[model samples]
Target: MSAFLDQLQQYIERHALFKSNDQLLLAVSGGLDSVVMAQGLQLLGYKFGIAHCNFNLRGEESKADEKFVRQLALSFQVPFFLKQFETSQLAQESKVSIQMAARDLRYAWLEEIRFQHGYAFVAAAHHQNDLVETVLLNLVRGTGLAGFHGILPKQGNVVRPLLFATREQAEDFAKDYILRWREDTSNASNKYARNLVRNKVIPILKTLNPSLENTMKSTAEKVALAEKVLARQVEEAKSKWVTEGQGFVKIDIQGLQSITNALYFLHAILQEFGFSWSVSKKVMESGSGISGKIFYSSTHRLLKDRENWIIDYREVAKFVPVSILPTTQTVRLLFGKVLNLKLLEGGLELVTILKSKSSVLLDYDKLVFPLTLRSWQEGDTFIPFGMEGEKKISDFLIDAKYSLFEKERIVVLQSGQEIVAIIGCRSGQRYSVGQATKRILVAELVFIG
Candidate 1:
């Protein structure tokens, strides 16, 4: 048995990555680490095939890489699958960086091939040194426990057999086997952030401790264990403070704030929803940010409304202010909400103006036709009827104790340039219907469709 094979067996068993009978799709980029992995897998006699993705950024080097991997596949006596991609075009189309485009394309294509060819797992060549670089990059970017864990040995159908092995060890293994591999010139360039970390930052840190990779790997394993314990605790907290629906989650802030580790609980919860640390901290420190205060993740939006933190999938709604006319009794609105209008012959109690936040009664003479129903704007000033002075709409919401999120969704019914009502919230005191008023215009906001 080969020395590399011994380590491979131990690594596989230690992680329970795969059994000997499982067919693996080895993603070989013709790079040293991948080539070494392919050779090691072959040496171990695992039923596997080679898959290569040629992301055409390096011109001839890209073509040569494909050729090298194809030949290596022949040498290994395994099935070969080759895919070519216009990486630059993909990056532009996907609106991601070139490296990110290549990564997404290759992985997606590899998985496609794996299922198509009936391979049990996709064996990737990410190793210990790469793991260290990932960990350092995450730390630099300020990640939580998940980032500290770096790369896992087994993730879904993907298995990294070389994760426990170092680059030097892979190079040594290749030398021992006299394996030929193609080198990617892009890896040497510090143009990419990961390359900068790998080339300049990791090298500098290596001087402080040559065993940095092993040390980080050890720490990562320890952190992974701690993360599980933390996750268990967070899940327990979730049961207490959080509730999930079909497309959204609601966190009871009142319950969350009572927890001693509220910050940690918030971090864990927000992280699960993809909110960054900066955004999460801001939300927590906001002292219950106004209703309609929205923080976005790539996939989700977290909103703060009074005592609850609501996380829901983001719907890209284009809010084009709807025109409300005297003839228009009802109109559909965004977010499954509706706005309604009514006209009454007689005036109601003037006290109702202060009582009902949902309906506002304004003297019909004070309001103009063709009202603009729209969300709030900056510098919008409104006089809550009977107030001595005009107040900034923002300050009024704060005074009313509306969350940032609620404030965002607050609709303003404008008569000409003046705010007649913060629809469903407060009507301008200036436009209040008095006892002498003969006609009343009721601007009613219907919350849902």
Candidate 2:
């Protein structure tokens, strides 16, 4: 076996990436690294198939790459899967960079194909230099310890058997085997940040330290080890600070402040929620007065409550205030719920309002047309059932045994300065269907989840 193949075999063994009998699905871009990996895996007598992604960014060039990969698979008489993506459009829609979009699209399709074909593993050609480049990119992007941990050899069913090899080794293997592969012109272009790092920054860095990739790889592994230790520590710290609920976490700021290097510890906790170092520190230093201060991630949120930090995942269905019209019989509410509004014909006493809180009978004459359905806010006052005076919406939720997520999810039906109903909860006394009521509006709230 060649030295590259020997190294790959050792890397696979060391990482325990896959079993001898495991079928593999290889991600091949028709590049030198991937071609070398495919050649090496074939030489090792491993049963595998090739998969290619045509990103459609380079038009004809993308097709050429796909064609080369298909031919390469056919030369080995292996099953080949070809997929195309509108990478730019995907990026725009996902609000991510084209590179990120392409990576996401490629992996998703690879996993899908792997699952369907009963492939035990999906292998990618991410070599040593690529690992170093990723760490450098994450460093520039201000990523924390986990980011410096570099790429994993195995993540779920995806494995990187060639991760121990370098770019130069890959090129040498392709040349020594007389293997042909397509070159992407985009690699030489510095338009993308990664391309800039590869072509411009790495060369200068390599001049100073010829073995930078190996050196950085060692350093990254150390960081990964440190991250593992920190992760254990963070878990203990979370036990002290974070109280996990149905869909949210309540972080005790007071509990965190007692620890040494609280800010650094806080960063580790907030990192999972995608909070930046600055924001994490801000979350640490924020005082009790900033109760409403909110830090947002793409999929989650951290709210600064008086003595605690509130971390919550965003609802799949967004909360939007749909107009409640008189003619409308039913309206769709957020999170798979429905609001049914109907006129109560005759029997309209406040006795029925107390029977079922979910379905409220309210005075139709008291409610104004075109009422709005919205989430509760601080200081929003309504005469809650059994209460003579108005109570703050926040206070009412606290008394309702509502969890943080439930409190945040509570919707209020409003008409002018009054709350017509607190949907899915209590009835507003101002709109209560009293014994003297002429008309009654039966507002029934149906919760889907």
Candidate 3:
């Protein structure tokens, strides 16, 4: 064995990613690096199964690669698994980039098989060159330190034993073993970003320093260490500022500025609220004190409140109010804010207006015939829902800390021209149940604040 292979063997043995009795699932693409990885693992004496994905992008070339990996696995008397994918179609359907789609499908299938067949871990051939290229790509794309962490030796159930090895090292081993590996013609085409980096960018750098790949890989290792420290800081900041309530989290915008990775911290916070990258950016830029101002995402909305941001579930279903036929039993209006109802008090027989309030549970029997629930009006006033006197619908809102915008859109319950309930905030104290009243009108407002 060559000195490089001897070192690689020792590196794998030291990691102990796989045991003598462990079964590993290796993702092979019939490329030089993967072939080297498979062969190297075999030499190290670990039992493994080879899995290949034929994305069908290269027509006959893809099938050819699959055939090579299959035969190679057979030669070693190991089991082989192969799957064909219509990657382009799936990518379009999923609204994701083709590369992302392929990755999602590949690992999803690997885990499924691993669970079914009892595999220790999924292994992929990600050599040092791939790590350097990935770090550069993410840097050019405006990524934070976390992005520069690059490929890990192991993530969850997937392991990359060859991450410490360079492409040159893998190619040298392939040559020494007399291994035949098929190369994808597209790799030389430069149509893909990674291919362009591999062919055009790295070559230019290699000219200046022949050890550019190794140097870049070493830099990635240092960046990974720095990124870990930054991640811990972000986690601490997140715990300090974010509070969970019911179905949403309240983010303190002012406290976020203290975090070193503010952008990453905001991104992770939005992610926890089910927002995507585009929506997360919008929410971050919206700043604070933007009450009722809303930013929409695929799955949720970031709603601004005083001193905080709220992630609200944007209900896709239309609000269809249930029909309520007037009965002696009081009807609950789920749609419109105001409920127009009649109340018969003492024999004095004064016009009483019932409005929405927290404590005003109206007597279902006292609500008069043909009560209608509808939006409030400009002249709306109710004996302020639990006070000794009447107050303008607008003035009641001001007392409740409702923003100016909320005052314009609030629905008021009216009986003819008289204001009854204000949906949620308060009801007319005049219409409240009193002594000597035979029955009471129950009108309540359910507020989705």
Candidate 4:
């Protein structure tokens, strides 16, 4: 057995990447590194199959690469999976770079194939140099401690068995075993950021320390260990400071402020919600500032309240004004909720139903047909069920102590020009059932997952 095979087997065992009996779907791009990994796995007698993605970026070259990988899989007498992607088109549609789109497309397809074929893990040929480049990239782009650790050995169902070896080692192993593999010309172009790091940056750095990859690997292992310890502490802190409720996450500002490097901790907590480290820093700095200030991410919004920082998912689509006709029995809200309308006899029976906040009983005759259900706008006013005087929706929300996130979600049911009810909250006095009321319009809000 070759030294490379022995080392690969040892690394896989040490990491417990997968059991010997476990089937692996190897992502073989027909490049030197991936081809070398496939050879090593085959020599070690591992239960594995080959998967290749033809990201249609390089025309004939891409097809040639796919054909080579297919032949290699056949030579090994293993199951082969091939996928073609309109990578350029996908990048434009996703509004991301070509590399990122290709990566997403390949991984998603790999995982899909893995699950369908009962593969235990999807193996990728990311060696020590790739790990080193990733860490450097993270540092260049500004990353947290987790980023310092670089690529993980086993993330989800993907495994990197070759992380123990450098690019030089993989090349040497391939040459020693008389292996032939296709060379991606694009890799030598240095047009991509990764290629720039590989060709220009690392070579310059290698002048100072020839064993830079080994050194970085050691450093990453240390950082990964430290991250595990910090993760435990973060979870503990989260339990004490973070309160996750239905539709919102509340973090105790005082508790966050008391922690050392509160911004780091805040970033750790808020990163999952798509909040950037800079935004996390701003949130931490706004601790002593006035409440109701909001910070937004692509997927979520962070509100700085008096004693807490609240986070909630941002609704992407604007709420279209939904018309609820008098004859309409049910209407679905913008979110996954149902507004069920029923005409009931206005009597003392409604007195018991009125106690439930989810349902409101209003006089049918008082409301205009085709009542509009829309998000509350600024300067919108309505009279509370028991009050004769009008109140601004903003003032109503404040008096009710609704959080900024809750206020954002509040929708009002409008009849003509007046807000007949703040859906799932208060009804207008003019629309309330009275002694003279003959029919009641029962509007019940139904919550659904």
Candidate 5:
């Protein structure tokens, strides 16, 4: 008992995770690790509340676990919060693995509750055994050094109090304290990859060397330190290679060539532009080709132009112009660009239609009569969605990061003098749609050099 207490005290003192007045949100699963963690914090007299997630995967067994945890919290006279997860549905919707989905939902909910309830930190029960397992998994899966670094003791507002303890130590403490905990049957089955490692690989490894956990933990610590140095170098390389543009980042091909790890540097820059790591690699590789190349990520696309790679936000660029019903004189904005009005089949793309799928295509049929094209003026306003009233077009333009010259050059496609779509800005929120409308204008931007 003294050994357990001594180790727990040493872990807390080494990490400096909490102060006397700190409020921690302890993640309790009614498992051995979590039970030991809660007891350790209690013994230390740290102020904390217990939180549990019931994923509803094991039917009665899941509820029983929750009940046990709730009663345990009551025994300690601590505040208990419980949440149910739609694990399968969430996994499908998020397009992530079940394990990843559960993790995201768990931490997101925990942080949300923490912020709302004034908790200083969130505590989890990940320990040395888990870290070793994670490192092994990452190595087997061909992951980078960061992935091999495994679980961190402190990450932002989340703290892992059991990081220094081995699974054997935790089990011993639980048994000595007579701590009752629920065991998930899935943990024993080899159906899951983690279970295969925990049950088969780790046991065989333990037989070979009982101190395998300690050795793996030491290796993970060394890898984490090396990764930190590599990360700092990558950050410095990124600053040299990337240039900030309006709503975009430009990568200098020359500067990128100077980077020590070009692939890593590209990954860092592309993430800043909201591109995926794979797409970023493709963009970087495409830099060698003579022709321009494009690769799409979830929210954006990387365009490798001659000497620069432009990461364009595809979502933001999906806007089409509305057709003008009655052709009006072209309005020449500050730039050489002119907004010409012409009759078409449908209302403008931005003004009339919004779609979840498809690019910025306009319906050219439903344009109203007397369309006017003009630049946005000061005090100009339009109705934007989810607002009580109209908003100034200039303010909207500023929010959208339009330069002075660009704002002056913005051509508004107006239907009968009522703004249908502020060309490339937003359709006047009020002039957009009605259920009765049959035809719509097809608006297209024509860039004249």
Candidate 6:
């Protein structure tokens, strides 16, 4: 066995990545690093299968890579799994870069295949150079301390067995073993950030430090250790300052302000909610200035309120005004709520029905048929229940102390041109069930799991 294979075996054992009896799904791209990894695993007598993803980004080159990986798998006499993806189209659909789309697609498929085929781990061929590049890229893109750790040896089911080796070491091993591997021409191009770092930036840095990979690898390890400590601290802080509810998270402004480097702590607290550092910085700076300033991430929105920062899922569904016909009994609303419409005899019990916010009683005779149930709009006016004067919906929500998210989700039941009930909150005076009412329309908002 070659010394490189021995080193690879030692790295695997040291990391306790997998056992000899354990099955591994190797992610092979027919590149030098992956090819060397396959050879190393084969020589070490581990049970593994080759899995290749043809992203279809390079057309003929991508096909050639798949062909090469398939033949290699046959030569090794192991099962080969291949998947093709329309990466460019997927990138557009997902609204992410081609690289990110490809990464997401491959990893997801790898995990799926692993579970289907009963593999213990999915092996990736990321070497020390990749780790160094990732750290530098994170720095360039302005990441937090977690990014400084670079790629982990084991992340979930994905294991990097070649993380102890550099790119040069992999190339040398392939050459020494007379191994054949396909070279991706794209790697030579400096268009992608990773390629630019690998082909141009790292080389420049290596002039000053010959052992740049090892140096960066050591730095990454130290940073990873520090990250663990910071993580514990952040968790403790979260326990004290953060409170999570059904669909929202609240961060106490005073608790956050008391921390040293409050902005950093805020960023740490908000990162999991998909808030960017810049957005967190803005939230930190907005202290005690105004309430109702909103910040958004792709998945969540943060609201600066009186004493807390409220984080909730950003509602993406566009509200089309739902038409409520007189015959209709049940209608589905946004946010897992169902509106059940029922006509009841008016004289039974009006006081009990008026108290609950989730259900409201309105005079069935007063409302026009085909009422519009839609999100509240600005300039919407209604005479609130027990009031004689018209009040703007906006003013009512403000007086009721609705949060930014609550205001966005508030729906109003409109009879002809006038709003009869602010759903789940208040019924308009025009539609109130009174002594003169014969039929009562009960609109109760039921929450579905």
Which prediction has the highest TM-score against the true structure? 4
- The parts of candidate 6 lying over 4 Å away from their true place are 1-10, 13-16, 55-64, 84-105, 171-178, 185-192, 236-249, 298-301, 312-316, 325-327, 343-350, 363-370, 416-418, 433-440
Candidate 1 lDDT by residue in tens digits, 175-221: 88788888888898999999999989998998999999999999999
Query: Considering summed lDDT, which 10 consecutive residues are worst modelled in model 2?
Result: 346-355
lDDT of 6 by residue, 2-53 (tens): 7788888888888788888999999999999899999988888888999999
TM-score of each: 0.70, 0.75, 0.74, 0.88, 0.71, 0.84
Winner on lDDT (3 vs 5): 5
For each of the candidates, give the backbone clash count.
15, 0, 12, 0, 19, 0
Model 1 Cα displacement at 161 (Å)?
0.7
Worst 10 residues of 3 by lDDT: 347-356
Which pairs of residues collide in model 6? none
lDDT of each: 0.84, 0.84, 0.71, 0.90, 0.73, 0.89
215-316: candidate 2 lDDT, tens digit per residue: 988897788788789778888998888886434678888898888888888888787888778777777778446567777776788878767788877544
Task: Choose the strongest candidate by lDDT.
Answer: 4
Between candidates 3 and 6, the lDDT winner: 6
Which has the better TM-score: candidate 2, or candidate 3?
2
**Candidate 1 vs candidate 5, TM-score winner:** 5
Kindly report which residue stretches of model 4 are placed more than 4 angstroms away from their true locations once superposed: 56-61, 92-95, 244-246, 313-316, 323-329, 341-354, 363-372, 414-418, 433-442
lDDT tens per residue, model 5, 104-167:
9899999988999999999999999899888888879866677778998888999998988998
Steric clash count of candidate 4: 0
Order candidates by lDDT, high to low. 4, 6, 1, 2, 5, 3
